[model samples]
Target: MTHVIDPAELKRWLSDGAEIAFLDVREHGQFGEGHPFLAIPAPYSRLEIDVPRLVPRRTTRIALIDGGDGVAARAAEALRDIGYTDVSVSRDGVQGWQAAGFTLFKGVNLPSKTFGELVEHALETPHLSASELSHRLDAGETIVILDGRPLQEFHKMSIPGAICCPNGELARRFWDLDISPETPVIINCAGRTRSIIGAQTLIDIGVPNPVYALENGTQGWYLQDLPLNHGQSQTYRQIDTPPAEAVLTRAEALANKSGVERVDSRTLDGWAHDADRTVFILDVRSPQETAADPVPGAIPAPGGQLIQATDQYVGTRGARLVIVDTDGVRAPVVASWLRRLGHEAYVAARTDLPAASHADETLPLLPEVQPADLFANGEPPRLIDLRSSASFRQGHIEGAEWSIRPRLRPEPNQTVVFIADDPAVAAIAARDISAERGAAFRLAGGPQDWEQAGLRVVATPDTPADDDRIDFLFFVHDRHDGNKAAARQYLEWETGLVAQLDADERKLFRLPGIA
Candidate 1:
């Protein structure tokens, strides 16, 4: 049986310092709409796949809320089925919490976003308005603009002449620019969090250049009616040689200032053995270097991407994270950023750890039905495409319904066929669905196979069914066609998070002279 926890009781637990996973089991859209200040999104549709990564400890105390949409009860059951021992449903969910007069925040990544606002307010991080920056460029000023977003995002849209130098790359790869200290620098992203973090990274490390965040970033540029360069792809190249002596010295001092730990191989092993605390071993290096010397169990995440999308990597707050890199500059810089995000992050010393040489596992041996065979059946199976809602809407087998893995509910005599972009995701969905139904099958090569076989695909603007949950708000600009209004709302909402954060005492944002 599942236990129901009241809003007041849960709030008390948080106030009283209990270590619990306060999960909001709603779609990302619903989550972004409003949720408790500390609720981490764990969408019900992808619970089976996401829970292992988000809540690693099977024994951790977890409470699920879903605004009384019945998702919380379903998630609790799913958690128990997956061996999660201490799971409970939030009493009345988000609605009840609101009725009880607690704050419900808007937007995703509130933790990081709010911390960015706090950093700016506390540290008075400098900024350069898009209009002024644009004017400077137009007047032939030699300002160097560095886009702090990921390469893909920078490629999408950027200020003219802005080079892609993602957050941690300001330390790892900025030397390649070789510009004089007198040349003023500006950093930007689609919006606030990454740009703020990136600019602050430079400021914290005492970079000789005058670094400033492009106020409001590319969105601000668009709002100002400033021209943006699209599809431009100038990116920073990795420096294969050892970092310069000055870079290493500054990185060490910053890490010390931020209270980042420097651990060795033995310390990593000890943390790995600890049952109480969850530990994540990440190799913060460029893709090329890690590909050549991959650590056995360490997840290969570039320093910049890891800091930008931290929730994707480290699930649990307060978890121990040990970042690995050979040259030492990348790991320490990223570790310092993680420290600001309230993690017990460490930069691991260069040790002769064994690289992974094991053979990769073969694909799962699951029953496959070709598109031609599927269509030729006497009564065609009820196709259930297990891809994301967006992908399904873009194009899927005609008459197919979109569904998430492990949450499919088939009707009597209905034959369900799972399909996804990745065969692995399809296979996992097939396994879970087949366990409930007597049999399940997947498209041999997913949607691509269906298309290759000259089968018809359809597109629709319809949202997923009411029962379906949108797993993630993949982009910050994912609202109302990503228009100016949505961008403006996002920017305004972000700036206001600091004030809301002042009321909530749970956040542990440590900035210079403020700890």
Candidate 2:
């Protein structure tokens, strides 16, 4: 049976110093528009698939919030079916929270973005305007630009000649860069938070070279009509050698300053066995590094992305985070930032961690029908495309209808076939449909299989329509697609995030020298 908690009770639970997975089960677009400050987006479409990764401890207290659409109750049932023990639904959902007078924040990554703004305000992190940087470049000044975003984002667009050195790797790899201490360095991201956080990261580590965040990052550069390099691959090279003693010392000192705990395997094991607390064993290294040296039960969360999008990885608000890495430098650096971000973060060596069991639940297999077989019976089966609306707009099997789990409905006698990139989504959707209707089959090998079979495909830009694309967030998406007005609006939203926070929300940040 599912329990029901009111918004006031949920709010109190969040501040009670207990691990609680306050999840918003609304779609990405709805969740991005507004949600409780501590709410993590676990859409109803991918609730089962994401819950295992977000809240590893099945017994962890979870409260599901929706947009008064009854999705939370459905999510609660799904979680219980997947071995989740303690789960509840927020009474009346987001509407209830607002009715209780709590703030519903706009935008994703509220905590990280707000903390970035607070860091800039408290530390007065120096920055350079786009026009100033442009003039300096024209003057042939010795300056280096480091793009703080991940390589994928950097590849899309970046400052000309900027190197992709994510903020997490800056402290560890700065000494490896063949640059003189005299050369000035500037760190930038797509917007304000990362640029400020990345630049301030270097300053906090006491780098000898002058450092500044590109004010407003790529958006700022674009607003100035400056050219951005596309399809760039320039990035910091990975070094097998351990960091220098000085670099390690700096990382350690910064972590200590932030009061990040240093724990060994024994402590981690004890915490893991503690039934009352939720502990996350995160391997904060590059994906390649983590794959090369796999740590048992460790979730791969690159350090930079972990800090920038903590909600994506961690769902429990007050859980203990044990960050692991092969080297001494990366974990400490990440833990320092996570500490400042108001998490109970710890650093541990990969060699010291003991093997632990990981979740291995497999999706139930669905009956598959070959693309050619789909056409053998003169009339084709009703095709339900479970892919993203954006992908559906780009191209899809002709006659297929795009739908997500929440909106999918098929007739009891209809022959429905699901086409999806992730088989799990199709499986879950099929399960739901089959419970009410008859059994449903999936397209063998998805749309690619249909294309290879000489089937007709079509593109319909207006098929799902903009309003129905709840999985996509168009608010900050258009900025990179040459929408100057959208870019300006995004920057304004980021800069104004601090003023939107209430007193309790502002108290979550723990900056240096600030009580």
Best by lDDT: 2
Residue 284, candidate 2: alpha-carbon lDDT: 86
Q: Give per-model TM-scores.
A: 0.89, 0.96
Question: How high is the lDDT of residue 475 in model 1?
Answer: 41
lDDT per residue for candidate 1 within 1-515, as digits (tens), equals 78998888887766444456778878776787788877887776556667776777788778888968676887788789778998888788899989988889887777778777777767788998998998888899999999987788888888888998878678877877888989999989888777788888888777889999889989898889778888899988765788789989999998998898787667666666667777667888777778999777677888877876676666665667788888878888899888886777888765734333234444454467888788776887778787778777778878888877435553445567777666556655554454644466777765567788977888876757534545545345453234887788788888887666534343566665444
Residue 7 of model 2, lDDT score: 90
Q: Rate the local accuracy (lDDT) of all candidates.
A: 0.76, 0.88
lDDT of 2 by residue, 97-140 (tens): 99999989888998998888889989999999999999999999
Give the Å shift of residue 124 in candidate 1: 1.5
Q: Give the distance in Å from residue 463's predicted Cα in candidate 2 to where it truly belongs.
A: 0.8
> In model 1, which range of ten residues has the least summed lDDT?
352-361
Clash pairs, model 2 backbone:
none
Which numbered prediction scores highest in TM-score against the true structure?
2
True lDDT of residue 381, candidate 1: 79
